[model samples]
Target: MFRTALRTVLAHKARLLMTVLAVMLGVAFVSGTLVFTDTLGNAFNKQSAKSYKDVAVSVTTYYSDDDGADGKKQEPGLSPKVLDEIGAVDGVASVTPRVDGFAGVADPDGKLIGNGWSNTGTNFAPGENGKDPAYDFTEGTGPTEAGQVALDKDTASRGEYKVGGPVRVATNGPVKEYTLSGIFTTEDGAVNAGGSLVLFEPSVAQKLFLKPGYFQMANVTATPGASDTKIRGEIESLVPRDAEVQTGKQLADQQAADIERELSGINQMLLAFAAIALFVGIFLISNTFTMLVAQRTKELALLRAVGASRRQVKRSVMAEALIVGLVASTIGFVLGVGLAVGLRSAMGQFGAKVPAGPLMITPVAVAAAFGVGVVITLIAAWLPARRAAKIPPVAAMSSVHAVATMKSLVLRNSIGAVLTLIGAAGIIAGASMGKDGKFSIGAGAFFSLVGIIVLIPLLSRPIIALVQPLLNRLYGVAGKLAGQNAVRNPRRTGATASALAIGLTLVTGLTTVGVTLGTAIDKATTDNIKADYMITMAGGVGGLDESAVKALEKAPGVSAVSPQRASYLVIDGKDSSASAVTPGDIEQLLTLKTETGSLDSLSGDAIAV
Candidate 1:
């Protein structure tokens, strides 16, 4: 049976190849997307894991009340008592604490450098934090005193500093001098990238930052042989309400989960695209199967007449489909791995860090691809199978290319058309109800697209008739034959057109949405930004102070300078930012358009106007 199937496929080698390629492409897309998803997910996990190693808990403090109830102007970090309590736990191994402070370091000659910090008062200190207190110096010893500092490799190398070299260090309070004592690097090298280093003692950082008794984190390491789960449970129970405890693995998982959640919508869109490709492939497969079965109907009928039962005939055809599907799916899976690599690389260009590795192809993926291929084949071969099974030997012997004549259903067809029209009318009526009802532009557009797809077949005859004259004029013989060919099998023609139209409709609708949204935003921004010269800060909101505005006014390009203040406000639990301009002479500076009243008469209540 397998040999027979192979022979049959070989006989129509070209057609078989085309069908197989179609199936392969669809399967490849599915495989590639799956691989990309897993690869990116793992990469993110690895990066996050490197950052949060051996850290059992973290605390981030923010103002939680309406009033400044606490007289302590600067909020205290995790107290020394909290650290001691965590360290005193039976399962706890050690506690390392470090104060958070901002400081600046300069080279031996006191040259201000971008790599190191300057004039920032550090306020935090580390006391018995479980993190390794000893520094892994790249060149010299850890900080010995307040005036002694250690620089990371980046700062040390960039500044041409060595051990015992004089490096000017300053905090927010005043400039302080320090000698370079030692340099070190973190395990992941992030410390160096951040252009900072640690002072071994809490007092040193406190002096540099101009604040005392404050720390960012109390990194707690588990005792040897301690299970992370147990440690996490113990730590969570003891940690303050504002603090959060998570195992290293849990933190990595959380990061991956967050990224996955963020990209879920994008993945859904990609899957939809893959499904569309599969759909396109299904049509091609169906066309091939229809042609194949039509060509071989006589052979099938003759076999049936001799000895073959309906069951045998059905099994034989399905077996052939399975063989074809297997071959196509295998080829597709291999190609898909390659496609995944390319997709990963493309995403990397867009700033995703996907490392090279074996693709995470699971059994489920293979099963899914094979299943889809088989299902598509069966659907494609369905009509042909029915026709082959029903044809009598005499009828089959009459003509090899025989097509079943669809019995005329003028009334039934008319009824279907009427029903479709009714459905469309209902949609239109619902849309007319507006905001009071559930109708929307999106719903209307969706229904319109679907209605067009459904009614295109009924409408195709007329549409083609209108185009036939033009086609006839363009190509004398081929055009006439094409017109006849299209109308000869209305159902087949309609099916083909419908399949192609799906892709076209998607493209058209997406284009319309893109254009409409783009135009709306562009028009809105253009109308809002009526400034001749908008002087703004270099980065982020609340940029460019009043002093900067004054300086800009002193510049030669000084025209009328309008300072706009933009600030975010939360109203009714929704956040909105308002860009406020000083209300000046409304008539001189700008002309405003109003739907209800003149801008000259507008009050503060109509500021959004």
Candidate 2:
């Protein structure tokens, strides 16, 4: 049976070409997604590990969005005294104070270096080795005074500033000029995404950021041969109640987990699209198998006449499908790995910075690709195999072509009609319920698609008849013969058209949804946004400082300014969100329409609808 199946497959390679491609393309989608996501996760993990490897323990202040008991926002910062106390601990080797802020670096032509969204600044606090652990300087040294600044390698290259040349810099405050003291490289995501990086002296950073005598956070390294747990415990006592103290290993693990969590949403979205591709491929594979079975009706009947059992014939057909699936899956997996490489390179070219790391191929990805390819192919071929097994042995010597009987056609159309009606009703009910009927809508779409595919045989006759007159007018006798051949085998006509219909419908629906959403978003933006300039941190990493707000308010040519902070809370035992904004002046920046309540008397504790 196996030899016979192999021989059959070898004889009709051209006939099975579409089936192989359908399986291969579906598997490729899944393999590509898995490979790209694996490489992404691995690169981030390696970058996090390298950044923290030298540390024994690390301390970072806990970030919060809530206000204090006094209804005033409790700003997060660490005093210099805390770093002093940590440095004096028994196992402490050194303490590095970190102060991060926003600094916009300008090109030599005096234009912003980034997209005018945000840039990053940090204090370059070098230790006894005259080097900051977080950065490696390629030229000169870390900034030493207010007049000097070190720039990241990309920033320096872009702004045309050498080690000794002046670089124009700006914060939320006034623009400042300073000589470039050094150039360095880093693994920071923001800087890699084309944001300028500015390095300042410890005191200078505090002064510019307006956080006097305090660091945003501190990192402590344990002395050689010291215990990380013991060092962490010693340092934890010196920090504030909301501050976090972690060992080096803990910090690396936490960073990796955070990255993975952020990537999960994107991975799921990619997987959903992959599944859709696989679903579409099923129709193509099944249709091809059905056509192949019909073409081989005499061959299958001859096998039965030669004493081949029904089960053996069915198994033989499946074996052919199995071989095709295995070969296609292998090719798909290889192409998927190449796709991952291309994806990473493409992202880099587009300025979405990710750490440069070797490609990662996990065992799960391999198993998943093959499993999906083989199973989907086998499922699509099952119906065709059953039909082939039912071919009569007498037909081996008969000249008449085998076709579906009147009774069978009636049965098939009845089932198709019932399913189509049910699906149409479900779609109507789901559409009426809006967002609350997501599950119903999805189920309705699935049923409708399946029903349409099944009813293709009956549906094709009417559609072909409609175009029959036009075909006769255009091509006369040849077109008339083609229509007669199509009408004679409704099953074959339906099978051939089902794949094209499924693909076309998906493309059309997606395009329509995309255009509608884009139009709605444009309308919403035009209606609400009234500000001349909207200041925002890249990726919403931080919010404006009180001093930064005051500077913007006082800057020349600025009329009105409003800053809004977003917070999530468990209000009345359910998760809800609130936006805190300045009173009344918010109207100056945005068009506000009140549904119920007024905003004129809005204060610290006031809520507006």
After superposing candidate 2, which stretches have Cα over 4 Å from the reference? 63-76, 107-118, 192-194, 399-402, 405-411, 430-446, 529-609
Minimum summed lDDT over a 10-residue window in model 2 is located at: 536-545
Please provide, for model 1 over 1-609, each residue's C-alpha lDDT reduced to its tens digit, 9 standing for 90 to 100.
Answer: 456556777788787786798788878877777766776666656666766776655434332333344543434455667677878876677676655445555555654433333222222222344223434556766664667766766567757877897776544334456777677654332242234454534676643332365454566667777777776677667655555666667766787788788667766776787788888777677667667777787777777779877666666666666778888888888887788778876864542334435567777667776777667767766665565566667777877445645443354356556655665665667678776545544555555555555555566788889999999999999998998878776656765776788788779978998999999997986776565665432222124446665676688965556566766678899988876665553333454656775555446666653
Residue pairs with backbone atoms closer than 3 Å in model 2 (clashes):
none
Local error of candidate 1 at residue 439 (angstroms)? 5.2
Q: Which stretches of candidate 1 lie over 4 Å from their true place?
A: 1-4, 63-76, 79-213, 225-240, 355-358, 400-423, 434-458, 532-609
Q: Model-by-model lDDT, in order?
A: 0.63, 0.83
Candidate 1 to truth, TM: 0.73
Best by lDDT: 2
